[model samples]
Target: MSDWKLFTDAACTEEFGGTLTTVHKTNFSDNPQDFVLYFANVAGDPGDNQVLELVEATQPGTNYLTMSIVDANVGSGHEADEITLATTAAGLDTAIAGASLDLGQDDDSIGVIRLLSGVSAAQEIHVRVENAVPNEGTSTELSSAMVEAISRTKSTA
Candidate 1:
């Protein structure tokens, strides 16, 4: 029989799960149109693995918000796809501008962006959000805009 086991003892075991960390909040501005919301793998014990969750409370504009992950450290070479938001739905919409997605209003519209690989400590995952199409609006305000990092853990049996 194998020595490996799954946790059954409630007092002696810790759950194989993820921890949520708040990364960023919206601070409205007019210029630049594009901004870096959060830089992952920079601070804290962001756990061993992670996925990004973006929440926008209000509709920023009629256009979509594009999210991309770029190389932060040379030779570390983490691979992840860019996510673009243009409408109010949950899932991938790749046909639009290098796989763009929509950022819908309210709590119901939570965008979950999964990383291609688990980010190593000190290796950065650069996240940016930009207006796909500019409008007459001077400032963008969200009722509740924030980014969260959800850590991933492994389970054995």
Candidate 2:
């Protein structure tokens, strides 16, 4: 079905099916408040020009995320490729800025900007096309597993 997929980091190696991204808001602001999200068409494929939406899989309260996709690109070569997000508070504010990710580059990549404590990992997130869900919600989840198959992993180490 949909070739697009989601990952926890820019490298796009770790999937979000069973992982947790640390919450980083006001009071619970983690060190690197700016979480990076790179959700593209597929692995190393880059450049499909997609508009992805991420919602708490089950719609929880504690994990409700205010974070959004601040920046994205071919996801291959950039100064911020693997750099830790938000060395400073100002940077974090910039990372989690929007609600949707636009992949107009038409390249292969994967990543995300999510809430940690405010956004609970206990619930499942449904990644789908913009206003075009077939199986779940308004659109179908962006994965190949017939069932929803997204991913996550915020380990700095």
Candidate 3:
């Protein structure tokens, strides 16, 4: 729908990341396999905001470098502004679709993104959005958004 920005605080204020908002984290713990993230859209047509991919920054592409997106949700709640999102994204028996998520809303988790296993070592993973055009030219990498320095201990059991 529109370009987005990143924020450290839950209120969505104090914008961090780059001008277009980049989510970069170094030394990411591997204990929590399920990682949570929020979403919001700006007022410009950037690209198709359909799916998200996890790849190593060193190997920037859909190569299954280090991480994986187990699952995702539209969002439980969102904010109209950079304030507290007092309202929930769903009401009654409405089904929330991740494909048609409201990018206009404030940062809110999609849902249940789990990782199979940690990387081989301390590696940087780049989380980027893509336009799923189904073998069409419409597909493209949406943003330079990324997360880096993810670390975890490989169990030797």
Candidate 4:
């Protein structure tokens, strides 16, 4: 099995909490691969709460990627979060395993590592962050560890 690693890490600013936006993209070779979504950072109003969503790019007229948290079953309405592993064929919404991320006084940031199944030198990957709930949220760019780790694994394989 190809082992995936961390390539990038990102932290969203206060300005990003307003709308959904693309944080960063990893330029990979044109190859089919699987991706694991990791929670790098998280922060919100402790009292009110919020949820963050990670989704895959949709391909018009296709049912893919489900909008659901992995660890926390709470809808995008409270202070909870989740993670999942996704693939180009499957998508982000559909994940195998994930977990909820809670923000503490100092635990305002989370980092996730994705493992690529089969990536070539032509295909690329990107991550999108959406403030599902309303409170306050931010994330760092995909960590270098996360990005480099993935490619390195491919080389060894």
Candidate 1: tens digits of C-alpha lDDT, residues 82-109: 2222322222232232342332222223
Query: lDDT tens string, model 3, 1-98?
Result: 12333433443334444322323232332211211233322222133332332223443331222212222222312111111111133221142222
Candidate 4 global lDDT: 0.26
Query: Which 10-residue span in candidate 1 carries the lowest summed lDDT?
Result: 1-10
Comparing 2 and 3 on lDDT, the stronger one = 2
TM-score of predicted model 2?
0.27
Instruction: List lDDT for all candidates, in order.
Output: 0.26, 0.30, 0.25, 0.26
Give one digit per residue, the lDDT tens place, for model 4 in 1-157: 1222122322222222212233332342322223323332232212212222221223211122222332233343322222232333345454333422221111112222222232221112232233233333443322221111111211111
Model 3 residue 20 lDDT score: 28
- Model 3 scores worst on lDDT over the 10 consecutive residues at 78-87
Q: Give candidate 3 misplaced runs (Cα > 4 Å).
A: 1-3, 16-30, 33-35, 41-157
Alpha-carbon lDDT of model 2: 0.30
Each candidate's TM vs. the true structure?
A: 0.21, 0.27, 0.18, 0.23
| Number of clashes found in candidate 2 | 33
Q: How accurate is candidate 1 locally (lDDT)?
A: 0.26
Best-fitting candidate, measured by lDDT? 2
Whole-structure CA lDDT of model 3: 0.25
| RMSD of each predicted structure | 18.1, 18.5, 20.6, 18.6
